[model samples]
Target: MLKPKRTAGSRDLAAIEMRRSLAQRIKELTEEPGEHLTPIPGLSLYHRTSPTPCFRASYEPGLSIFVQGRKRILLGGTEYLCDGWSFLLSSIDVPAQSQIIEASEKTPLLSIFLRLDMPMVREVLSRDDIPEGPPSAHRQGLVVGETTVGLLRAAMRMLELLDTPEDIPFLSPLAHREILYHILRTPQAGRLRAIATSGDLVQRTGRAISWLRENYAKPLHMEALASTARMGVSTLHHQFRALTGMSPLQYQKQLRLQTARLRMLMDGFNATTAAYEVGYESVSQFSREYSRFFGLPPIRDVKALKNVNTALESVV
Candidate 1:
């Protein structure tokens, strides 16, 4: 028996239905307005009732898909905006600022985040079925792309495991693999592939990044960094800047400033204490740098952040 041919209209309708299904499932999983961690490892859901102040945080390698509303992420000097039909991928650990740009009490921002498993990514790449692409040298570690039905369906199924807890152990891996497979085939594949490819400049830059992260408080020696990355000094500087959009020293400064802010905000450390703790030799220099980075002096910024938190707590 011959099967009926599918029409373009039918395909369009099916895509619409899938989007609706994804939105419904995501909303169901995120019932309240907060970050919700799930039973599955490295999977989380987020919701917000209104527009939020820009948030500075570091993102590990992961994928974030918004089912409702929009977000803007700032990496160094670049800005990326994504809506319900789009997704963002961070191929490496990066410190960035992001904010929910579109949301309301009635139609809050709902989103899901899945951390990428590098081992699984390598496994997929090792398969002979996967196609090869030109190696990318200067691609940033972050990418935003419009979503497709196949990717949406896979993500929805991964979320569905939240309701069917019993099936998660067996089915979650498969769902995650499917999601990665779709991502690998996207235009961002070259950058993503380069992150995992051995001896690639991006991978070497990543090694340098890892060392900086681990030794951020120590004095930065250019020769040491170049040796750690197994690259020449000039190549390390150029490739590191190309991949991360900042010089190594600038990146270290970001790490130090962010860490100091967290210590002051969360650990009740004072400006001088926090500054020195993160390797700032001079309190005045720390204050100057902190003000430049966070738009206020250390003491004032901490007070402002505390007030914002207090206001949010009162609202909640």
Candidate 2:
């Protein structure tokens, strides 16, 4: 069956304009070289220039829409590309690498990140009459969807709050809730549904993912995890791979490697100690895997990161 063409409503157009305005506001705020941390609580704006591959963790689940450049995020083995016209939504905290694919000194990658809140998501889901989805299947945690006017408008309204600090304390939550409501009702609702509706297989798989993130270095017992997620082992495996683009084990390995890298950078832990901390047993095995993943040995990679930090500090 063919899908019908989706149209943006008047409200959606308003959202686009609002995003443009917000982008302008962010640019104005950051006339100098530094990140502009928005005054709005739980929300932030990102502006990056120099083209390079940087790894980031989505600590807060939110929507990332770029107005100027493109970003490629590797979640598990699957890759998602989001540009000006598309939005990337990740509902879970998964370790990933995002590279700036397109950016220039003139037109940098301009983006607005709305920090998603569990209370707001649940509140919207409570009152809204969201459409019933097909029998739940494992849905990917991150997806690239065509932007809609309605979605954009809600974001714009939320951004407008930045200019009025007093309004934020009372109205910000309401605006954020409206955004979630719009998402729940849009065609992209499936992505929201896969995560929003709890206890379904996909939701269960999400729980499993949360567990892996916190217990990255620990042994992954599928049966035990499945039990915790209220799913069977077979079902858990299928859903976990489908949503994350990698099996549970692969996801765990990535987390371990990323954590070890951070340890080396911040605490000056050597390869052996860092490996042990992140659950690797043999020193040789840790170095081999670290090299394969990061393109350099632990010590070399740490040194390179330190140098880069120094250079950035000097410029700042």
Candidate 3:
């Protein structure tokens, strides 16, 4: 028997239905105009009513799917833009600047974020049924790709569990595994697989990254990091930059500045104290670098953030 060819109209209708279903599910989960954590572990919903300025934050390993509006994420000098039909994946921890580039009061920005579990990914990869591919050397850890129907459906099933909490314990894990399988079958799978596989250059770089994350407040020595990753100094530097989009020193500086900002905002620390707490030797250098990174000095930036929070609270 011969199968009939599918028409473009049918395909467009399918895509429209997928987007509509996902948008409805997300809106049900997100009741307000902010990030909302769902019952399913590692799954969260985000809703924004208007476009916002770029904000700096650490993006851990995860997958983000947008069902409405669009976003721009800046990693070093590269910018990744994604809309309702696309998604973003981060294979490792990265410091990034993200902005909501498109949104409105009526048609808000709606999205879902699920933190990737490396252990589960590794288990899935170990199965003999998984396809094998050659490892990539120069690929960055962050990638944006179009979302597939299978992946989107699996994600929607996972979100559906939020409405029926009793079913989550048994079915959520399976749905998550299916989602990972679909991701591993994408074109950007090589980088994600390398992050979990042993002895791969990307995995070795991840080890170094783990070390830096653990000891970001300490003085860094390239030799020590290279030894820990079991790579030559030159190779380590090359691979680290290839994966992270920044040199090791620059990466450390981002961590320090971000941490200092948090300390001032949450712990009520002064500029000098926050600098010292994050391993800054010279307060003057810290202030200069902080201003350059955040576009304002410590006191002014902190004050502005507090004022914004206060105004939002008053409105609420």
Q: Cα RMSD for candidate 1?
A: 6.3
For residue 211, give model 2's deviation from the true position in Å: 3.0
Where is model 2 more than 4 Å wrong at Cα?
1-20, 29-41, 49-52, 101-106, 117-138, 181-187, 198-200, 299-316
The order of the candidates by TM-score, greatest first, is 1, 3, 2
How much does candidate 3 score in TM-score?
A: 0.77
Error of 2 at 180 (Å): 3.8
Cand. 2 Cα-lDDT: 0.72
What lDDT would each prediction earn against the true structure? 0.80, 0.72, 0.81
The lDDT of model 1 is 0.80
Q: Point out where model 3 deviates above 4 Å.
A: 1-11, 50-53, 103-105, 119-138, 198-204, 227-232, 262-271, 295-316
lDDT tens digits, residue span 1-316, model 3 = 1111344453376667888899987877777889998788899899987665566666788888888898888776677887877777887776677778787667888888999888898999899999997675536767787777777888888888887899988988898899898888776677668667634776777788888878999999999999999999999889888777888888888889988988898799999999999999999999999999999999999998788657645644
lDDT by residue for model 2 (122-237), tens: 66666646556563343666766656666677777877787788898899888888777766655566766555664467667767888888898898888889998898888888
How many clashes in each structure?
Answer: 0, 4, 0
Candidate 1 residue spans exceeding 4 A from truth: 1-17, 39-41, 103-105, 123-138, 198-200, 314-316
Residue 155 lDDT (model 3): 83
